[model samples]
Structure formats: structure tokens, C-alpha cells
Target: MDTITTLIERNDDFVENRFPSGLKLVPTLKTLIIGCVDPRVDAAHILGVQLGDAAIIRNVGGRVTPAAIEELVMLRKVTQAGGGDMGAGWDLIVLHHTQCGITRLGAEPALLATYFGVDQQELAGKAINDPHEAVTVDVAALKASSSLAGGFLVSGMVYDVETGRTEVVVAPSLLREETTVG
Candidate 1:
């Protein structure tokens, strides 16, 4: 049959034979991964993340845009609604990959500006053309978000499409850490 039909058949088999039952609304690992929308860089497949392991958010460039931050806020509210807190020791990961379509959009300044909701002049600060740099930029953005609260571990990773390997661009740390400069 067609691709959709085949997928539907697979789903039927999944629901009937192999679906895990009684998974909680909260992820088992209490982790959320923000990654590029590229199918080849799917965190679930590449990272061997099984069902309910971690929640995944995919978008262009996997940048920490305002919309993505809002999603995190909403997710926290959602977990609260489900009688679970999304704060404290939860893990947040930003994933970017090589050969992303967003790289191509960098050549189109107007489009890139529109996508980032920033002026074309400010696009250089976004590091749109580099996955490693974008990951660093995105993770820092998350760490700096006041709306996200604190006590969450956040990291950045870059996936290499050619070698199917991932490198940690930023080591995990508290999303909001208190620093006292002496």
C-alpha cells in the first residue's frame, strides 16, 4: 500500500501487539530534547530513545526562538496540570545537526530574519550557519530564560549526519544556576 497506509497498518500492529500500557504523562527520564526538524537527525532514532523516555520538540535550526521558549513554559504548565512539576533537576537538551535546511535559509537574509523574528542586521549573532555554534547559542538562551525557572540540567549537542555520531557541544548543568562573584 501507500506510505500512509503502511504507517497505519504499523500503528494498528503497534496498538494491538506492542504498545506500552500505563505510561505516565511525565516522561520516564524527565527529559526534554529540542532538536532540528530534519528527519535524519531524529533524536528518538539516533539517541535510541524509546517511548516515553523524553519529550521531543523539533523546529527549523533547533534554535531557541521565542516560540520554543513559550513551548517550554506551556509544557511546565501542562505538567502541573497533570499533578507533576516540570521544575527541579529535569533535563533539557538542545540538539542541532550538520547539513540542516536552516543553513540554506541563511543565504536568504529576509527569510532568516523572518524566521528568527529579528532584523537581518542582527542575524550574525544567531550563528545560523553553524550547528555547533547554534547549539551553544541555543543552550545559553535556555539557561538565560527567566520564565523557565531554575534547577534544570541543560546541555547542547551536535549530530553529524555523515558519521551518525553526536558530540556534546555544551556539558549539562543547571539551567539556572546561582553564581556569587567574590
Candidate 2:
């Protein structure tokens, strides 16, 4: 069978045998995970979270660029539309991993700079070579973003591919004050 057909079969199985009916629009776990696009590192599988448990956003290197910040803004809008505010009682997890492919792109400063929406000289601050440092940077960025102004506990994590383990680099804590009411 083709990949799409096989995926359809999996969907059939999910609907018939494992679907959670009446799942709410908001994540039950009250968490949002941002992670890399690498197939080896899946936050859902690593965290053993079922569907509707958490909202996940994946992008290249999982770095918090201008685009990622905008995505968070959109998610806040989505939560508002659903009658739930993303600000309160939410955890934003910046998940990175070891031996990331993003490190390979460091030589292509132009591409990296373009992807991050920053000048080539500013690429040094991104810490693409180290997952730990990258997580720290991302957590700080999320915490300081007024676009996401409001209540959220932000944290950072690093997953080890060799051992299939995840380490919390930054523990969850309220990142900002509630600036606007829901």
C-alpha cells in the first residue's frame, strides 16, 4: 500500500478503536509544545500524550523566530475564539534535541539568517549549535514577547536521541503578568 493509503488505514483504526469522543477544542493538559521538525524527535511520542492533550507547533530547528512568535499570537486568538484564554494556566514547552540537523546549516549563514528573520551577524545569538543554549534562548524570547502578553508558565526541555530521555532545562514558571483580560 502507498503511504497515504496506509495513513488512511491508521485513521480508520483510530476512529474505530481509539478515538476519544467529545474532545474539547482546548488542550486538556493545558500545555503547548514547540519542537523541531526532525522525524526522530516527536514530542507527542516522547511525552506519551494522546490527541487533544496538548497543542504542538513544529518548525525547522524548533527555534523561536519571528514566525514562531506570530504563531503563538495566532494560537492565542484561537483560544479566544474557543472561549479559552491561552494566557492563563498554560505551559509553553520549548523542546529541543541532541545532534540536531540545524547545526549543519550554520555554514549557510544567509539561509539561517533568512529563516530566523535576522541579520547574518545576529545569527550568533541564536545558539543553533547547542540545544541547551537554544532552549534557554527560546524560553527567554517567549517570556519577553509582549505579543504573548499574559499568564503562562514557560519552560524549556532537551531530548536526548541516544537514550530516549527528555531533560527539563528550564522549569515551568509564570512568564508574564496578565496584561489583557479574556
Candidate 3:
């Protein structure tokens, strides 16, 4: 009848019918995705990934904050401690969507604070005026983190809610500027 009750009932069918036993901690695709909390932008559905394929981190704006980086580092540590192949390529995808709620909060600091329960100053870096630029900034932040090794691939993409299309804003190879031509 209620939301939780519905989910619990559904989960019963899931566990009984299709839930796999003893899945590995390592992602099958060896990737992690950071995306917005918008319901319209379902990362797994849009990306065509099933469960156990990747680790997903969702936030208000999909911004790569310090806390997100910490979680990533922990993931890496856990994977290594489990004797998983760390040298295998790990892709970090930062996915943002068009018409996100974060953009609406840019003009209303009071509303943003009320929603997130923080002061205005704390929300300074959380604004998303442009999804393209925001994705680039977030990807750069994740790539620059020392915890994430150089072998880790980081990319930025924007999912169009209107058209159900995803555009690559920043490729993993282009995360940094190329200063010279070979």
C-alpha cells in the first residue's frame, strides 16, 4: 500500500526469482558512475547497465565533491584488499542531465540551503549554471584527485531528458589540456 511496503513486496519477488547469490564486489564493467539524483535520469537504464556492472554515486548536482572522492578512494582500497585486479582499467563516468533541479536553485540560495540543510556559504560550489561546464569541472576534479591513480579513466557526459540522448562533454583522454603536439 505504501512506498516502502511496495518496494519490500517487489524485493521479495526479486530475491525469490532473480537475485543472484554471492556476487563479487568488483564491478563487471569495472566502472563507477557519479550522476544526479533526478528520477528522470536513470543511470543504469540510460547506460544499459545491469546490476553488478558498476558502482553508482548519486548526488544533488552530480558534482564531484570531496566526499565523493573519499568514497572512490575507499572503493579502490576495498577492491585491492580483496585481491581484485586493480590494474584493470576503471572508468569513472560523471553524468549530468538537462533541466536539472540544481540549475533552478542557482537563483534561490535560501531554497537550496533549506533543501540541503546547510548555509549559503556551504552551497557556494554546488551551483550548476551550465551542465556542460559543470560536467567538465566535475570530471577534472575527479581526475585530479591523487587517490584516483593515473590509470583510472574519467569521462563527462550529459543526458538529455527530453530526447533520451547522452552527449559526451569530456572524453577520458582529454581530461587534461594538451600543451604540445608530438
Best by TM-score: 2
Which residue pairs come into collision in candidate 3?
none
lDDT order of candidates, best first?
2, 1, 3
Task: Tell me, by lDDT, which candidate is best.
Answer: 2
Tens digits of per-residue lDDT, candidate 1, 82-109, equal: 8877767689999999999888875799
Cα distance off (Å), candidate 3, residue 105: 1.9
Estimated TM-score for each candidate: 0.93, 0.96, 0.81
118-141: candidate 3 lDDT, tens digit per residue: 588876554467888888878877
Query: Which sections of candidate 3 miss by over 4 Å?
Result: 85-88, 108-127, 174-182
What is the C-alpha local distance difference test score of each model? 0.86, 0.90, 0.78
Off by over 4 Å in 1: 177-182
List pairs with backbone clashes in candidate 2: 87-151
